[model samples]
Structures are given as C-alpha cells and as structure tokens.
Target chain A: MLFYDCSTAPNPRRARMFIAEKGVEVESRDISIAKGEQLQPAFRAVNSRATIPVLVTDEGTVLTENLGIAAYLEARFPEPPLMGRSADEKGLVLMWNAIAEQQGGAPVADALRNGHPAFKDRAIPGPANHAQIPELAQRGVARVAQFFDLLEERLNESPFIACDHFTLADISTFVFVDFARVIKMRVPEGNTATRAWYEAIKARPSAQI
Target chain B: MLFYDCSTAPNPRRARMFIAEKGVEVESRDISIAKGEQLQPAFRAVNSRATIPVLVTDEGTVLTENLGIAAYLEARFPEPPLMGRSADEKGLVLMWNAIAEQQGGAPVADALRNGHPAFKDRAIPGPANHAQIPELAQRGVARVAQFFDLLEERLNESPFIACDHFTLADISTFVFVDFARVIKMRVPEGNTATRAWYEAIKARPSAQI
Candidate 1:
C-alpha cells in the first residue's frame, strides 16, 4: 500500500499513528499542506477532494478518509484489535471514536482553519479557496474546553473510552487531546482521572509514533 | 432505547434515520435547538456536550454521538448488518462514513453554526457560551459545494458510497445530502448518478422516519 500523508495535519497523523500501532509499514509520501501541494494537479489525480492521508491499496483501490484507513488496517491486523472484538465492544469503540471526532477533532479544525493566518484563503480542506473567520476560533476554544470536560467525565467511569481495552477510540481521543494544546487548551489541571489516562496512553509505543 | 433528537438538525436526523433503517423502535424526545432546550441543565446531565441525538440505552448507557448510537443499534440488531460482513466491506463502510462526516456533515455545520444569527453566543456546542462568525458561512458554502463534487465522483463509480450494498455510510450520506437543503444547497443539478442513488435511498422506509 502507498500512504499519502501530511506530517503537520491531525487527521493524517491519526492514520499514521494507527498504522504504527498495528506494526504495519507502507510506502509513505508526504503531501505538504504548508506548501499547498495538495492542490497540485498531480495530487488531485490521487484524490479529487485534494485531501491527505489517502491509502492506495495494491489492488488499486483508494481509501481517502482516516476512519477508512484505520478500519482497513484494523481488520487486516487484528492482533491488537484497535476497533474491538465482540459486538458490544465494537459498538463502544465506534461510539467513543465518533464522539472524539465530532466533539474533539471538529473543534480543533474549526479553530485552526478559522484562526490561523496560514490558512487565510483555505478554510475548507479541498482545492477551493475559502477565506477564514477569526471569530470561530474563539468559539472553538470554548467547545474544546467542553470536550476536555466530557473526556474527564467519561474517563472517570471507564479505564478506557470504549471497551476495557485501548481501541481506535483511544487513538482518536488521544490525538484530539494532544491537539488541543495547539488551541491553548489543556486537560484541565483538576481533571486528575483524565490526566492519568492521558499519561498512560501517551506511554504506549503506538502513541510515540 | 430513548433517543434525544431535533427534527431540524442534521446530526440528530442521521441517528433517527439509522434507527428507522434498523427497524428498531426507540422512544425519542425532541430537544429543540430553536427553543434552547438543549442548554437546559436537565439535558446537560444526560450529555455534558449538550449535543442533540443522544441515545439512552436499556443498560442506562447514554450514547451522545450519532456514530455511537448507530453502532449500538447495529450491534443490538445485527440481522440487517449496517456496517458490513467482511473485513474489506467493513473498511469501506467506515471509510465512506468518515468521508460523509468530514466532507459533507462538517462543512454544513461550519456554515450553519458560524453563519446563522440564531447561533450567536452559542457558536459552539456544549454548555459554554460563544459568539458566531459570519465569515465562516462563506467558507462553508464553498466547502459544501466541493463536498458535492467529491460525492458525485464517488457515486459515479459505485452504487453506494462504500460498496455495492447499503450501509451506515449511505445512511450518514443521505442525511447529510438531505440536510444540505437547509443551506439552500442541493445535489448538483447535473449529477445523474448521485441523483438516482439519492432517490433510491430516499425511497427506503427508514429515510421517512
């Protein structure tokens, strides 16, 4: 498989970390968002959406989204079982992962795209040129704080976000929590449970990658 | 299960439609965003994020994300297999679902939350208060258009967004496409393949609910 990645982006980083977690290796190509290479014709041919973290299987099938890539890798390498094993476990994994994406990942993107001057005319992810909105960043900061609170509440109840094991939900949530630092949001100093869980997950070899 | 829903919101509608598609009967309570009921402390107790479309399971588990509710429902009622049966199939379902969430749903939300005057001082989800950004709406419009193009390109190659059969990806995509109407954006006029697929999916009994 050939994986098109962007080192700076959170979404692609999720995929990269997942692949590393599964102990799988693929030919990696950098799609530099900093230089706007994703908008180039050569890259557009790979994905019309002009996004990164695309995985092209040896069969010539293109998987263009992070969840897709993660799912594929999880299924192919089931030893670690990042998604989950049983029916209920799978459901929990999916649930937590979605929450992380919507509550955590989305807000980070909103803040970055709307606040960062580097993305001035590229608020959206595709090839199109769309201007930024600085106000969204302020809102994003508030939403992210809430996200941290939500995670704290969840972590207080379960050792892991989904099942009792470390799943893709953990990966997504970890990335989101770490990414929150960029927006000047931290896991609240008072969120003891969340901080402990975050430290534990961070120590995982997969997280280091 | 009891579902907290809002008829007008796209995310809640996706969960409602997924339950409908699964042929499961859920006790649903409408949390009116227009009325600001989602901000009530009563609702916040159920979901700290204060987002709509939360599912309270028989086990008293409160699932707060659309994908979370869908996952739980699909697992509980597996006869229809909304995710998929095989590994590759599962990967495709997850891939397309993420694409729909990121490309279709996220942009629509960016447009609505940032553009709508109604969401002023409530730009982000959760109990916190934040203001809106009108400029994000313009970027949202452009991003949503690009999303349509991406969907059209995918639909042109396959009957469903994922594989040959209907799955959660289709459910999510259908809700997103239908919800885009709120922003006055419909599927592009000339995309015959997408239109046909949309009609067929729309005809499903689940879509009406």
Candidate 2:
C-alpha cells in the first residue's frame, strides 16, 4: 500500500498517528500543503479532489478520506483495533468518530481556513477557489470554543472520547485539538479532564510523529 | 429497538429508509423538529444533542447519529446488507457516505439554516446559539451546486455510489439529494446520470416513509 500524506496537516496526521499505533509498514509520500503541492496536476490525478491522506490499496482502489483510511487500516490490521471490538463498541466508536470529525475537526478547520491569509480563496476544498468569509472565521471560533466544552463534558464522564479505551475517536479528537493551536485555541485551562486526557495521548509514541 | 425520528428531516429519513430495506420492525417515536420538540426536556433527556435519528437499542445504548444507528442495525440484522459485504466494500461504502454527508448533507443544511428566518440564532447545532452568517448561506449554495456536479460525475461512471450494490452510501446520498429540495437545489436537468440514479432510488418503497 502507498500513502499520500502531508507532514504538517491535521487530517494526514490522524492517519499517520493511526498507522503508527497499528505498527503497519506502508510506503509514504509527503505532499507539502504549504507549497501548494496538493493542488498540482500530479496530485489531482491521484485524487481529483486534491486532498491528502489518500491510501492506494494493492487493489489500486484510492481511499480519499480520513475515515476511509482508518476503516481500511483497522479492517486489514485487526490486532490492535483502534476502531472497536464488539458490535456495540464499533457503533459507539464510529458515532463518536463522526462527532469528532463533524463537531471538532470541522470547526477547527473552519477557524483555520477562514481566518488564515494563506487559505484566501481556498476556504473550501476540491478544485475550487472560494473566497474566505470573515463572518465564518468568527463563527468558527465560537463553534470551537463550544466544541471544547462538549469534549470536556464527554471526556469527564468517559475515560476516553468514546469509551473506556483509546479508539479512533480519541485519535480524531487529539488531532483536531492539537490543530486548534493554529487558531490560538486550546482546551480551557479549567477543563482538567480534557487536559489530562490530552496529556496522556500526547505521551503516546504514536503522537511523537 | 426504539428509533427516535423526525419525518421531515433527512438524517432521520436515512435510518427510516435503511430499516425499511432491512425489513426490521423497530418501534419508532417521532420527535418533531418543526415544533422545537427536540429541544424539550423529555427528548433532551434521551439525546442531549437534540438531534433525531437516534436508536435506543434493546441493550439500552442510545445511538445518536445516522452512522451509529446504521452500524448497530447492520450488525444486528446482516441480511440484505446496507453497509457492505466485505472489508474493502465497507471502506468504500463509508468513504462515499462521508462524502455525501460533508459535501451534500452539510451544504444543504448550511443553506437552509443560515438563510432561513426560522433558524435564526440556530445556525449551528447544540445548546449554544450561533447567529446566522448570510455569507455562509451564499457559500452553501455555491457548495451545493458544486456537490451536484461532483455527484453527476461520479454517477456517470458507476451505477451505484459505492459499488455494484446499494449500500449506506446510497442511502446517505439519496437522503441528502432529496433534502436539497429544502435549499432550492436539485439535480441539474442536463445531468442525466444523476437524475437517473436519483429517480431509481426515489422509487424505493422505503422512500415512501
């Protein structure tokens, strides 16, 4: 399998951290986003969407999204299951992972893309150029602040984002929260539970990447 | 199993259609979003998110999102599978389902919520109130138009969104495309392939509910 990744991006980092946790050996090619490499014709040919963290399986099927990459990897390497073990667990894991993507990942992305000058005319993805909406940047920050509160609430009750164990939900949350640094946001200092959880995950060897 | 649903909502309709396809008997309770019933104390006690399409399993786990409900049902009833038949197939199904959610579902929602007077102070979900960004409404309309183009392109090459057989991916795409009506968006008249696929799914008996 071949993985197309960007060393600095959050979405790709989630996949990178996931692969590291799984101890999988796959060839990697880094596509630099800062250099606008993802928009290049070569990358577009690989994924017309021009997104990174794409996995080209041996069957030549190109998996374009983070969930796809995580799902395929979890299915292929079931030993250390980052997704979940039982039927109930799988459902909850997926639910929370989707929450992480939708609630956490998306807002962080909005704050970054809409506020950053580098992303002007590129707030949305794909082969399109959408001008940044300043109102969206403000909205995104407000949303992220609320998202942090929600995570703290969820993490306080459950040891992890989804449940008792570290799963893809945690991976997704960690990546998003870490990326929130770009927006000058972090877990509120008073959110002790979230801070503890963040520290624990940060100490993981997979997080070193 | 008990399903909490909103008849007019797309996400809930996704579960409704999936359950119909599976031919499973699930006791369902309607949570009316139009009346703001989801915000009531009783329903909030069930799903604090105030979102419908929640599945309360016999095991007493509340599956809150479309993916969670779908995963639980697919696992419990594996007949005429709407998820997928294999590991690779599952990955592809999820990938497309996510595309439908992010590209199709989200944009349609943005257009409706950000532009509609009824959704003022509710541009974003959850307990917090976010003011509508009129600019986001325009962005959403543009995004939905692009999403239609992408769907048309994909449908031209494949009979189904994910693969040969219908799966959750098809269910998500169908629901989102249908919900686009609320945003005054539909498949362009010239997009024969998308129109054909949409019409075929529209004929499904499950769609009637």
Candidate 3:
C-alpha cells in the first residue's frame, strides 16, 4: 500500500496517527502543501482534487479523503479496532468524528485560511483558488472558542470523545484541537476536562508522529 | 427507532431516503425548520446541536449527524446495502460521499444561505447565528457550477458516483444536485452524463420522498 501525506497538515496527521496506532507498515510519499506542490500536475494525477492523505491500496484503488482512508485501514486491521467494536459504537464513532470535523476542524481551518496572508487567494482547499473573507476569519475564532467548550462538556461526561475507550473520534478531535494553534487558539485554561483528555492523547506513541 | 425529520431540508431528506430504501419502519416526528422548531428548548434537549434528522435508537442513544444515523441504520439492516459490499467499495463510497458534501452540498448551502434574505444572520447552521458573507455567496455560485462539472466527469466514467452499484455516495450526490435548485443552480444542459445519472436516481422510490 502507498500513502500520500503532508507532514505539517492536520488532516494528514489524522491518517498518519491512525496508521501508527494500527501498527501497519506502508510506503509513504509527502506532497508539500506549503510549497504548493499539491496543485501541480503530478499530485493532480493522483487525486484530481489535489488533496493529501490519500491511500492507494494494493488493488490500485486510490482513496482520496480521510474518511475513506481511515475506514479502509480500520476494516483491514480489525485487531485493535479504532473505529468501534459494536454496531452502536460504530455509529457513535462516525457521529463524533463528524462533530470534530464540522465543529473543531472547520473553524480552525477557517481562521487560518481566511485570516492568514499566506492564504490570500486560497480560502478553500482544492484545485481552485478562492478569495478569503475577513468576516469568516473573525467568526471562525469565535466558533473555535465554542468548540473548546463543547469538547470540555463531552469529555467531562465520558472518558473519551466517543465513549470510555479510545477510538477514531479521539484521533480526529485530537488533531483538530492540536491544530488550533494555527489560529492562536488552544483548549482554554478553564476547560480542565478537555485539557486532561488532550494531555492523555498527547502522551500516546501514535501521536508523537 | 424514533427519527427527527424536516421534510424541506436536504440533509434530513438524505436520512429519510436511506430509511425508505432500507424498507424499515421508523416512527418519525417532523421538526419544522421553517418555524425555527429545531432551536426550541425541547429539541435542544434531544440534540444539543439543534440539528434535524436526529435518531433516537431503541437503546436511547441519540445520533445527531447524518453520518452517524446512516452508519447505525446500515449496520442494523445490512440488506439492500447502501454503503457497499467490499472494502474498496466502502472506501470509494465514503470518498465520493465526502466529495459530494464538500464540493456539491456545501456550495449549494453557502449560496442559498448567503444570498437569501431568509437566512440573514444565519449563514452557518447550528445553535448560533452568523452573518452572511457576500463574497462567499458569489464564490458558492461559481463552485456549484464546478461541482456539476465534477459530477459529469465522474458519471461519464462510472455508472454510479462511487462504483458499479448504487451506494451512499449516489444518495448524497443526488440530494445535493437536487437541492441546487434552492440556489438557482441546475445541471447544465450540455452535461448529459450528469443529467442521465440524476434522472435515474430521481426515479428511485426512495427519492420520491
């Protein structure tokens, strides 16, 4: 199997951490997002969307999104199930992962892409260039603050993001929370539960990558 | 199982159609998004996110996102599988589904919410109110057109959005294509491949709902 990754990006890190947790050995190539390498013809041939964290299985099928990459890996390596064990658990894992994407990941991305000069005409990621909206950048910071509260509330009630055990939800949420630094956001000092959960996951071997 | 629905919304329709295709009997309650019923205290108690298409399982687990609801239902009823039959197919299903969401569904939503007067201070969905960005409205219209092209390209090569058989990807893409009407967007007349694919899915009994 072959993996297309971007070392500094949060989305790719989620896939990287998942692969590490599963103890899977796969060849990888990094396509630098910082250098605008993803928009070049070579990367576009691999994924027309020009996105990273793509997995090309032995069958030569290219999985372009994080959801697909993680789902395939979880299915292939069922020993240490990171998705979930039971039917309901599976549902919760996906649901919470969606929350992490929509609530946590999105606002952080918006704040960076819309507010940063480096992303002047690149508010949205893809093969195209989109102009940034200053209003969205301001709103993103506010929403990110709310995301921290949401995480704190959820973590206070449960040992992990989805349930008592570590799962895909934790991986997704952790990456987003950690990536919040790009927007000058962090788990608020008062959010003890979220802080504790973040510290615990930060200690994991898979997260070290 | 009890399902929370809003007949007029595209996201809720995705869940309704999935339930219909599965031929499962689920007790449902309509939450009028037009009436702002989702923001009511009662609805907020069920789903703090204040979104429609929530599923309260027989086990009393509340699923607030479409991904979670679909995953739970698919696991419970494996027949007429809407996800996929194989590992690669499953990955493709989700990958295309994400594309439909990011490229199709999101742009359509942004155009409508940012351009329509009815959505003033409601640019983003969920519990909070956010003002619209006119720049995003213009960008959304352009992106929606590109999304039609992307679908046309994919459909020309494959019968369905994901693979040989219909799956969750088709359902998501179909709903987004149909919802483009709200933003005054339609399948371009020259994109015959997309038109044919859209019409085929439109004929499905599940889509009629």
Name the best candidate (by lDDT).
Answer: 3
Q: Model 1: per-residue lDDT, tens digit, A1-209?
A: 99999987888888888888888879999999889899899999998778888998767778877778877777678877887776557667887888788778888887988888788877668766777767767767777888888888889889998978888899899988998877778898999999999999899887776
CA displacement after TM-score superposition, residue A184 of candidate 1 (Å): 4.2
Worst 10 residues of 2 chain A by lDDT: A82-91
TM agreement with the true structure for every prediction: 0.90, 0.98, 0.99
CA displacement after TM-score superposition, residue B126 of candidate 1 (Å): 3.0
CAPRI verdict on model 3? high
Which residue pairs come into collision in candidate 2?
A: none
Ordered from best to worst lDDT, the candidate numbers read 3, 2, 1
Residue A44 lDDT in candidate 3: 94
Q: After superposition, how far is residue B1 of candidate 3 from its true place, in Å?
A: 0.3
Off by over 4 Å in 1: none
> Could you give candidate 2's per-residue lDDT for residues A82-132 as a string of tens digits?
877776777898889888888888988888899899999999877889999
lDDT of 3 at B39: 94
Using TM-score as the measure, what is the rank order of every candidate, best first? 3, 2, 1
Error of 3 at A146 (Å): 0.9
Can you write out model 3's per-residue Cα lDDT over A1-209, one digit (the tens) per residue?
99999999999999999999999999999999999999999989999888988999989999988899887887777869888887788889999998999888988998999999999999999988898999889989999998998899998899999977999899999999999999888888999999999999999999998
lDDT of 1 at B104: 83
Candidate 3 local lDDT, residue A54: 95
* Candidate number that wins on TM-score, 1 or 2: 2
Residues B1-209 of candidate 1 have per-residue lDDT tens digits of 78899988888888887887788888889989899889888998888667888988888877777777776777689868888776677778988898888778877876887777787867666677766667767767877888888888888889998999999999899988888887889998898889999999999987876
